[model samples]
Target: MANEVTTAPQDTRKPAFWYGLPVGYMSLDLLPPAERLMEIINQLRGLPEQERDEADRALRLYAGIISLLNTNRVQECALGVHPDDAGGFTTSVFTVSTLPTSGSAKLVVAGLAGSAADGPDEGMRPLELPCGVGFLAEKRSPAPRSSRHPERSDAASSHIWQGTVAVAAPSTPELIVLQMVTPDLDSADDYRNILLGIARTLTFTDPARAMAADEDREPEAPTGASAAMRNDFG
Candidate 1:
């Protein structure tokens, strides 16, 4: 697996905002579960007849379902904020179709505290970003060689590209993690480039600054009876 990390200066704009995917790409939310399942079945049908061993077929199906479930979990995580004692975390995922022949890509975002660190036992490789650090890793599972076609034997691979950004905050440092996985190595580079571009748009703001900004805003007048009295007197 090949891994690389690029960094940029911190953006102090919106602390929280939505990230968009490239054109020609779509999220799983746009596709219903039943439709997605049918797509998977279609992909399986495209596999060569020799590659249709029971074990291999089962593994491919399992992997597809697992990816779908994981993406759903991330989407649920994105719906709310998670604040911890020091800081908190939230995440989201989007499944994209790059091309008909090229496999889909999974984009993920994880927001947390910069103070927390990765464990040594973790198998992920380190990726340094301007705000913080990140990790990247890949996994491969060898498909059982077809008894008929001995010459063709390449294992299926999944590339996981992940990065962490440590936003500059006064007390509790905010962190953001961006990740994307491409099941097919042939188009992994394209997916990686798309994710990197999205990661670049991340901006951070200090909690203190946000609070102060809120305080500076003028208070709204009371409504109904209070508003009528104020309008009549003033």
Candidate 2:
């Protein structure tokens, strides 16, 4: 059981890549980017003056990075902040992009692996996600190699951690690739678990129809206002 890959109950619906946000993660609006940026800036109004200034600068820089990704076919980006016991914070980034051509899931995995197999990192393995069978891999920062002396490589004291997952979009020729990066390797297992949860939320169903289904399942509220009038007095 320990060696098996745990997954969520299958959701047999959708023709689009609609996924749910994981806890502590905020999704950025990609439909014209600026709309979401303004929303985030407004939320910083409650912070201390100095902290707010610092956060503003950082947010602008991050927003620029997202803009560059949008030019490519990246559909979504999310940021997660987790508080630690040591009174500090750890952060992670997640992005989803659709591949250019249509192909089977096996072909998609092969293409992803062929491109990164040369990188120095842990090996890739089969991952059983709710969407379907997929592949997962962890990548580490490469040590800087000398340009003049290609034979000699500089040893790096530390490196960053990144995780990638590739799953095919159901009923479509598209393939979706998910990538996550974090500075803290100590919590790699926990981060991986979060990635698994996010992957399970993926579906190829139409967002409009899926949302309508959810509304249909919701319980109806009390009809009359007279039965529910409790405002500091019975």
Global lDDT of each candidate: 0.37, 0.63
Q: What is candidate 1's CA lDDT for residue 62? A: 63
- Candidate 2 error regions (>4 Å): 1-15, 33-63, 102-106, 110-122, 142-157, 206-234
User: Cα deviation of 87 in candidate 1 (Å)?
Assistant: 48
For residues 27-137, write the lDDT of model 2, one tens digit per residue: 766554567667887888878999999998888777787678767656667788999868998888878877655557667766666555555545576677655777788
TM-score of 1: 0.31
Worst 10 residues of 1 by lDDT: 98-107
Per-residue C-alpha lDDT of model 1 across residues 1-234, encoded as one tens digit per residue: 011112221232222422333333333332247767677677767887766566466856666765765544222111212222445432223331111112211112122122123445342444443333343433433434656556654443323333222222222332234445433444445545545554433323333453466568776643332232233223
Candidate 1: clashing pairs of residues: 131-166, 132-166
The number of the candidate with the highest TM-score is: 2
Off by over 4 Å in 1: 1-17, 30-72, 76-132, 139-177, 204-234
